[model samples]
Target: MKHIYTDLAVESKEIYNPEKKKEIEGVSVEVADEKNYSVTTVKVLNQKGSQKIRKPLGTYVTIDVPNLDKTDEDLKDEISIAFAKELKALIKEYKKNKILIIGLGNWNISSDSLGPKVIDKVLVTRQYFINYNKEFDETMANVAAISPGVMGLTGIETFDIVKGIVDKIQPDILIAVDALSSRKMDRISTTIQISDVGISPGSGVGNTRAGLTKETLGLPVIAIGIPTVVNAATMVNDTMDLIIHSMKEQAEIGSEFYSLLEGLSKEDKYKLIEEVLSPFMGNVIVTPKDIDVLIDDLSIIVANGLNIAIHPGIDIADVNRYIR
Candidate 1:
């Protein structure tokens, strides 16, 4: 049984035994710690590196902005500029061609609405180019986007819908945006993970479906996502661990109850607690009470970054002017 499950590659590193895994050649990791945000870049080299890291052999860039939940426009602009820089590096090779952006989620759910919300704020130039034909600025990419509602609502596979669009547009690259699930509650709406390896649509929330990746789409796919919810079981386990540690510090060393709690192996403790809570809260997901506010701020931040990345002539100021 897996001890922990996380969609974030950085978190996966925390669980694996460092002694058993050697640093593969060509794989690189760099971190930038700033006052407002932290950026972790994981570049997987060969297939061997991918296996060692349990991630696709591509670049995974994660930006953690702790104050995202709080309304901080100046900090938001900083993050947006930083995030756009990272995106430009990843898609620099395909700047001369069309780009398709897919917003994957159920808009009716507040936590899941991040992708669609971002789509709403993006500056779509595809229609203008088609209708005008060389009238608009040549620097602007032929950028198009869609918010394909979730499988339950549309009664269609997300992959199938995306594949149809890909076949028609044949974009040089695809950028997919979706809400993700993280093991820690604090990451919800606060962390953005961008990967050249693409994404698994429903897999983030434990519903594994056909993924949207380079292998499936036959083109380079970039995925951008934010952790919007966390597993309920993990929430309970973390709380119990804190309680057990507190009890251990306060209680005598040989106290039976304290000893019992401390003696249970991590795996066994998780199993025991999971079984006890399974009847009521199996596969439960927890989100913040202020998710609506968080989503609004994050959507603008992400959309602004995309606008700057897709349009070479536009700056953060230009994006803000157009968006407002």
Candidate 2:
């Protein structure tokens, strides 16, 4: 199988079916159009679906905001609401339980700083509950967060750090936020993927560590990720597709050139592109020029969604007030 590096499960499904027509045996997909964005739910139902998509058996919700690059408050709110709705559905049963949010990334890098930035804005009430010994209120649940730097900086495995905290705090559930890589350029910084199967930190960049899942943590883990980068080879492959499409449009349908273009296999082309770029730019990752600003806006959107979803007492209006 041709390895296509993408953190979004929707992309994986798309790759599985380039024509977007056939349905995988055990996988199911449903898409709903929202006011400002669209929600795509891709479920890997069983082992067959899991192996077909190369994803674990779980639900992956992708919030696609086409105008994500635009800095508009209304758009942000709409996306945040959609995000909260999806996240709420996933953790509805544990809404009143103790939740630990782990922000997994390096704060120094702009592309990878989303996790830490979100931690800055998320409402953390666990400290209050611990210090004052306050009982659970309707307005807020016991929430705690940590921005554990990458292993390179902390010299400690992320899972170890999280395990220790989980053992100490004994939170009922875990929510991990991190930056991810996508196969499409347009998805970079514009897509949010929420999954119930948990995530392997640094997996998108090929430095995968121990996975943070129910099997490992002994608690349900919800992973929320935004694509901050895309593989350069994948971008080139997409560009090639566009070019071929443009040529085919101008050429006669029955012409030899048109036939050749139609017969060009995406998998073979992607492999060729990867081979050609390997020597010059081995596993090169690409991010948008405005990634810094994109991350700032996205972090706020994600934090607001998380705040509203995890704390029923907080709504969109009150969520921004808590964010710096």
TM-score leader: 2
What lDDT is reached at residue 172 by model 2?
90
Residue 68, model 2: lDDT of 88
Count of clashing pairs, candidate 1: 0
Task: State every prediction's TM-score relative to the real structure.
Answer: 0.90, 0.96
Per residue, candidate 2 scores C-alpha lDDT tens digits across 1-324 of 468888999998988777899999899999998767889999999999988888999999999988887899988988898899999998887645698999999999999999999999999999889888886778888999999899989999999999999999899999999999998998887899999999999888788999999999999999999999998899999998887778878877555676686576767878889999999999898988988999999999999999989887889989766564
Every candidate's lDDT: 0.82, 0.90
